[model samples]
Target: MKWEDNRESTNIEDRRNSSNYGSKGRGGNMMALLPIVKILLGTKIGRIVLVIGVVAYFFGFNPLSLLDSSVTPSSTQSKVVNKDADDKSARFVSAVLAQTEDIWSEVFKKYGATYQVPKLVLFRGSTRSGCGFASAQTGPFYCPADRKIYLDLSFFDELAQRHDAPGDFAQAYVIAHEVGHHVQNIIGTLDKVQKAKQNFRSEKKSNALQVKVELQADCYSGLWAHYSMKNFNSLEEGDIEEALNAASAIGDDTLQKKAQGYVVPDAFTHGSSAQRMKWFRKGFTQANLESCDTF
Candidate 1:
């Protein structure tokens, strides 16, 4: 990927130097509460208490009163880093975001709609998100509630060293896929799918729907790649293969099999390696939004 000299996005929010444990900083209160909540939820007694709390809520009891009010949450000041022009990773991310902005803007113009750019948040360890408290373990995600993309640059290292998918374009593909989710949010596709999920009684069905959503994002990433290639001649010799390798590496099936030594198709939130690669290729070759309908 030839992105070094490209334009960097102004919509980036750098929160990498903030403490993950919720010292006095943005979203500190929520961040402080999440770990306690998680620990409580991990126990059987805590689960019972949670159920009782829900039951109390139905009976007109205020569950908020159960929280300790004496513990004052203090805010920590965040030290934003890499503001200088030489931060390679941050620069690469901003450049990729700019490309997505340009590509999607043109695509939306053709459809007689204006594109609203989404903010890209760069954080470290953990951070507060509109969706909920986010940790590095949650990976990269797009929160529709905030219309922003959250990422930890450490994940790129994991993508290279742990997942064995290295290369600048592989990293770019990850950003593009998350941006694709922002596009879905803009087009009301995410809203419709979320509404449909409300009626789904089976976890399998819900997972299938999620798979479609993720695959569509993958396809949209390819659409961006197609346009980027034509518009800026951004792709190098092995860029497409790098992206394809990344898609394959992060497939739900691949991850599941690695984690458990078996595959559970019904539990897959994202598609299989073959499906991901296929959809991405479809969008790359077709180079049209209509071809990205995974559902």
Candidate 2:
């Protein structure tokens, strides 16, 4: 993964230190009361009270309730801070993102279509997304609604220490996989699958569809890898192995077995270890977009 000298993407939004939940002040305290209100409104009596309160407020019957001084709104501000250690990871991610943009732009040109680059968001703890509130626990995800990829750099440490998939290339593969989702969104694959999922009544069928989506993204990641290596000679000796190991480590079977000491094939939203590795290899060896049709 010789990416240090490569170009960095300008589409990156770094919100690593921003607090989306709220700031620790009067506004924060008021915002923090929302969850409690939601919980209380979950009950029948509380719902009735809420309805009455709303009605009274609209009729000006409860002016004091509407003019609560403690519920003042405040603007949320974000502050950007860079840590020395994270700077290296940020550069690597930016480089990988830029490479994907270049490769995919070329690939799309061959198909008589223009590629629209997606933004990449680097955040920590929690952040607001078009899809919803996101946290590091949600892992890396691509929100088609916003056409952006969100990531937490700390996941690299978890990938290395917990998943046993150390190496810069493995990290690159993760970014590529999410970018692959953006590609699927561009090519209408995600739209078709999502439409089909709407008619699926069974959880098993839904999960199966999700598995196909995930595997295809994996193959697309490999497609990027294939061209990246061919175009820029970016791969080192163990890079491919690092990516394969990462695919295997995060497979549905491997993760489920580790979490619950059992495996449920029907619950697999992603494929098995063998399936993930095979699809990735298929795209890598074939070195073309046609080889990435997991559906």
Candidate 3:
């Protein structure tokens, strides 16, 4: 938690000021046209047009196509950046990223390999990623295609308020977990997992494999914490507890139960609450690569 005095990473790409808000998600364009549709439907002439459009729709003529063509998704939205307010949060992220770089670099040295550091991207509402166009709704993730970590600092606030997992360490754990994915990417674990997932015909079986991958990342996060504490004595009181609470809070079972009032293990891509906490503890206590083999 003593991160302010720590070194900040220079590999950060701050795109917070230039917000890209366009989303090509399903029903996104339709949702954008809602206000226009509501106004049109409120008019008497619009009712006639709507009835004619419905008849035309049944007759193989589409009127909605014209409306769809006219609506352009906003690609660039200017967002005022509060430099003073975001400076501390950005520094904290940079500090955590620096720690991961140091920890992983040292860890990779033991294996006789050079650690290729990944870039961390900071964006506001939305931005383009190598994987795809992403928004804050996507949360923090590592895109193997670009070898970069995309993050919106606002997710930390959501983590605290919505998930009941707060604290600096919890935020660090998130960055560490994404970095763990990058570790998997460089070490060929991600490629192997992707190939294996492709071989599975059943969605459930594939999801099970994904759970293994996520649990391993959780373990690697704990591994990061282990080295971070040993090397820099960074952990303070309740730090580990904050991370565990975070891991538990974001567990597939916990989120599913919270959202739907029930849990479906078959649909779980990430492990259960107990499984996540256990793997994290395993890596922390064992502090070895062998102990993190969730596969």
Candidate 4:
């Protein structure tokens, strides 16, 4: 939680307020078309003549050019920009990301494999992505297509307020977990899982495989924690507890019980609450990639 003065990440891409509707800028052309349509349709002022004039106006024969893509968007918040985070939460995320890039790059070097440092996208509302479109509702996801991590900053608020995990370390765990997916992608583990899923006839079996993947990511996050604590002195009073609490709070069982007033182990995609904490602790204790082989 002591990350106020830490260095900010240069790879942060902030896209907080972008609109998906094409033809940007207050929907001006569409708005203009609507009123014209109303007048032409409702009245009988030589509808054919109106159509010609309307067509001419919409086709750039009009005085104002409303077709520019740049002017179409009503706001620029959704396009990545360097908006000053200037806050404790945002600053901590940046530092954690930079640290992961360092630790993972070195870890990969030991195996003689090149490590690709992933970009961290900090967005609000929604934004376009190579994998498709990402929204705040998508939570945190890693796109294998682009090798980037997409996260909505509001997720920290969700962790603190909804999950009862309100520490800087808890947020860092989330980031590391997503980065863990990137690790899997870089190492070909994720591609193998996808192939296995294709042949898996039973949905239940595939879900089990997914749980292992999720748990492995948790373990990988712990591995990062071990090094981060050792190298950066990132640990503080109750940091691990905060992460454990978060792990438990978002467990499939816990979330299902809360949402449906019941628990179903058979339907869990992520590991059980206990499993999540166990694997994370395992990684933290072992502090190596060999220790994270949950497969």
Candidate 2 lDDT tens digits, 1-295: 8887788999899877554542234365556567756975999987887788678757645322243543212122222245777878888899999999999999999999999999999976667678876666788999999999999887888899989999999999999999999999999999999999999999999999999999999999999999989988899999999999999999999999999999999999989999999998987899678888887
Q: Per-residue lDDT for 168-219 in model 3, tens only?
A: 9999999999999999999999999999988899999999999999999999
Error of model 4, residue 4, in angstroms: 3.4
Candidates in order have lDDT scores of: 0.86, 0.85, 0.87, 0.80
Cand. 1 Cα-lDDT: 0.86
Per-candidate Cα RMSD to the true structure, in Å, reads: 10.3, 9.0, 8.3, 6.6
In model 2, which residue pairs have backbone atoms overlapping below 3 Å?
A: none
Tell me how candidate 2 scores on lDDT. 0.85
Ten-residue region with minimum lDDT total, candidate 1: 70-79
Clashing pairs in 1: 24-75, 24-76, 25-75, 25-76
For model 3, what is the error of residue 165's alpha carbon versus the real structure, in angstroms, after optimal superposition? 0.4
Candidate 3 or 2, higher lDDT: 3
Off by over 4 Å in 4: 17-87
